[model samples]
Target: MTTPADTTAPPPRRALTAFAWFWVGAPLCWGLYELGVKAAQLFTG
Candidate 1:
């Protein structure tokens, strides 16, 4: 007997939720702020 074709749908994607985004983005924002302050000091000093 022939085998039947697969009919199941693909699995859902793993998306980044808001809480995860905040956790990841907070440090990045802090680093950018610090870099901007340092660059300003270099220009003024």
Candidate 2:
């Protein structure tokens, strides 16, 4: 006799969450940092 097949889905991953956060957060933080660096130009003549 053969065994039954699994229909349940896999659990979420913390590593994948961290990786996704880093993927988005890194660029966001970098853009904010660059914006801050260049923000002075807005006030300058």
Candidate 3:
């Protein structure tokens, strides 16, 4: 009889995860900052 296959998945790499977040989070924060600046101007002006 043939053996059953392995079902478990591999764990993620920490460095790659952090690098991915940095690349993704920077632009997201910048967008939020710009939006806040616009909103402040809209309310104050």
Candidate 4:
């Protein structure tokens, strides 16, 4: 059976996993957006 010590432990590692995904995805998304804007400018010019 569980005990009080187990209850007192920190939250699980889900936040760390989420943050890792964000860390990898955010820059990739930003780069894609920047590239799209530049491509549009090239076509419009």
Per-residue CA lDDT of model 2 for 1-45, tens digit only, reads: 233457555555768889999999999999999998799788883
Predicted candidate 3 versus true structure: per-residue lDDT over 1-45, tens digit per residue: 233457454554678879999999999999999999999997898
Best by the TM-score measure: 3
List where candidate 2 sits over 4 angstroms from the true fold.
1-12, 41-45
Candidate 3 residue spans exceeding 4 A from truth? 1-12
Taking the candidates one at a time, how many backbone clashes does each contain?
0, 0, 0, 0
Q: In order, what is each prediction's RMSD in angstroms?
A: 9.0, 8.5, 7.4, 6.9
Order of models, best lDDT first: 4, 3, 2, 1
Candidate 1 lDDT tens digits, 1-45: 233457565443335456788898999999999999999998898
Per-model TM against the reference? 0.57, 0.58, 0.65, 0.55
Number of colliding residue pairs in model 4: 0
List residue ranges in candidate 4 displaced over 4 A: 1-12
Which candidate leads the pack in lDDT? 4
Q: What is the full ranking by TM-score, best candidate first?
A: 3, 2, 1, 4
Worst 10 residues of 1 by lDDT: 7-16
Better of 1 and 4 by lDDT: 4
User: Tens digits of per-residue lDDT for model 4 on 1-45?
Assistant: 333575667566788879999999999999999999999987898
What's model 4's overall lDDT?
Answer: 0.85
User: Measured by C-alpha RMSD in angstroms, how accurate is candidate 3?
Assistant: 7.4
